[model samples]
Target: MCGIIGIVSHSAVNQELYDGLTVLQHRGQDAAGIVTSDGRHLCLRRKNGLVKEAFRTSSHMRKLKGKMGIGHVRYPTAGSSSQAEAQPFYVNSPYGISLAHNGNLTNSSSLQRELFEQDRRQINTESDSEVLLNIFAQELHHQNSYRVTPDDIFKAVAGVHKRCKGAYAVVAMITRDGIVGFRDPHGIRPLIYGARKTEGGIDYMLASESTSLVTQGYEVVRDIMPGEAIYITHDGEVHTKQCAENPTYNTCLFEYVYFARPDSVIDNVFVHKARMRMGHKLAEKVQNEWKDHDIDVVIPIPDTSRTSALEMAMTLGVSYREGFIKNRYIGRTFIMPGQKQRKKSVRQKLNPIDLEFKGKNVMLVDDSIVRGTTSKEIVQMVRDSGAKKVYFASASPPVRYPNIYGIDMPAANELIAHDRTEGEIAELMGVDRLIYQDLNDLKDSITEGNNELVEFDCSVFNGEYITGENKAYFDELQQKRADSSKKKKNKRAAVDMCNSQ
Candidate 1:
């Protein structure tokens, strides 16, 4: 959904925050922001752009002066893409808290009502992050403490767990003392905390993925457990509390298959290794289902599927080649807001190496097929490149339902596999054959070696919402997304019309 990083260090942490955001840029592309506590006042900088663009000038970086800070890279899963919705959402009350959150909150409507009518707080933006910040600020306000204690932080976080329903991993700057991080009761999102000793003292970082911690030269302590709250004091003391009385660990399985970086590890499971296992398991399916068909060359769709493609090629005794060269300038097509933009991005994002496809039966591997737009375009590209046939392979099972939890697939009809059989999907994509990994194999690949985490939130593929099913709520969300998309389109159209004048 999004990427977040928080740090409590003895030194000015602008460079570290900037670099961490850059590394986690893949998780979000719409906007980036950083909020720092100067001990006296909270310094905030946010904009609707990539991380580097957001901090293009040294002036932008220098404005945020603090030893403790938190940053966010956003991909609008809960709100429309705009400067106003970009996070490190600041609420000027109860220690001047600024919050950045990843994943969506399913009970945001109810929470908003409670904030308005009961708590008498007003939310400024469309972001659920702001709602969360207000709720947290309200809880801390009720505590009525002169100064914040770890116990106070625990109480506020426990209150949040009780009130909010959905996946969230939050990092907030408390303005007076330090930073706070917490995960949802179901642990539907990812959060990890790590620390390392500097010459002055210990530096701590909490991030959506462990890669940020490793990149920032901090050794991972461990994942912040399900429903756990952590506070890193100004003097580098770390305090933790198990806020949720009974927490279930159901992490998002899609992270292993597609979302996370290959180098990052979440819930103690290596994402790259899990994808490789997925490839191995898919190879077993291929051997059983398509042993008669000959795949002359295995070409990965590029980027996320590289590990799985390599392992599948090795197991199937097929040659693996890098067929598509993705342009670094383009963002992920799947996350692009509009269908037209997504289609256009697919054309610009990747270029096929004709040599790999010429006069060969090419099997294309991707992590999954959501709407089938990218898959269809890639299949066409491969066919045009002189490939005799294009076979499609998916690392995970078909996404057959709407993912109301955090993923952007909110409309059921928008899903290509929603009501389509395997044969129908293959026909729709115009591929020679489609091979999908089994749902059971998908679960095993992520959990086979990891002992700390057991299950995953597979709502998109399985149609089972761990948080609870609210069809009316999800339908409302879908309508909101559609309305936002139409507004964006209409605004663009009006600008074009005026320009023509």
Candidate 2:
């Protein structure tokens, strides 16, 4: 997953874009980029690092000029971690468009071949965002209009919805025209637009989360609907159109379990509130199953799971304590590409508080267990800290299938809970008991917040791909992940040898 933001303001938006990206830094840590349009001239700056690292100096910010711009923080779910794949990808054709995109396209391989053979466009990197940019540019070119209007832009977006087969939330700047924002038909990813009234005129901003807009004093208008496209002219005029054939509002459930910030709202449901409901629902299961449970204290894994853990403690009538002190400097272990990197980072990322675990029947709560590397390690850490009994609870159900849209866990075997029963998983993790939230209860948790949300992209738990199940695609994805893992291992060995010399 990635974070994308775009702005059309009465003044220069370089600093605003930078600050917005900083707020969204949790969405991605690998790379960051920003592109600003000064009339017809586009100024670009992108690098393989966090937003603060990428735009470090005054000169970097000063170089970016314009009233409209787009920014991106990338976590590579589709491509390698090379600087060449860093985004805010630009194409000169179709009136000079610079685009930033979140979410992954499942049909990108076929689209890449189509672009080269049929569309006569060249793809520079392994990134699907580049292919998407070219597709949008090509579609706009088909419009054949010297003066592009909102209708032409909406038509181009419709062409994109017809061709692309996976999730995408895009924000593009068309040189002198304005900023455009659109969501995929399924709404598998989040995209919200808001407005801020300025002294000069009304300014508009679009981003992957509402936090990016609200933090900047922008009043959230609403989430850009499934299969909808919104165009904000350079003069602050707004126009929108439904671009997809038959759109459904199936937002990704993983966003509520993890990823999204607690303060953000998506599809009219508050994220933190949903997570609290998850804790309450999971608490019901615990109360029914383990009536005489001796959970001494409920301790959260830290950061993302804190809200749920606290609620779970309150519901279960157990004392809540902060057991893990997280190192804020460490990158998220879940998003790290390699298993070795993730394993190594867990210790550096979190340290167990001896007092919380010592001689107590400790119950640890985490958002969800994917690979189980971190969970197993944290369990061992709790044991090492003298815990008498260690129990674990997952706020969401087991991840049994691959998340093809945009998450990193592509191989089923990599998921500890994929083919294992609850008892088997508990044994493997060395926990005394393990409780996982039921899928139906998890759905109710979110639905309680917003009744309108009828479905979600819970493909990771149910193996039900909303786009359609393709065994060939799964096979290819597994092979790609295996190959990438080998390459990373070899590269690490080479680096270690060089350092020793």
TM-score of each: 0.96, 0.97
Off by over 4 Å in 2: 483-501
Which runs in model 1 stand beyond 4 Å of their true positions?
483-501
Give the winner by lDDT: 2
Put down candidate 2 lDDT per residue, 194-230, tens digits, no spaces.
Answer: 9999899899999999999999999999999999999
**lDDT values of the candidates?**
0.88, 0.91
Q: For residue 299, what is the lDDT in candidate 2? A: 95
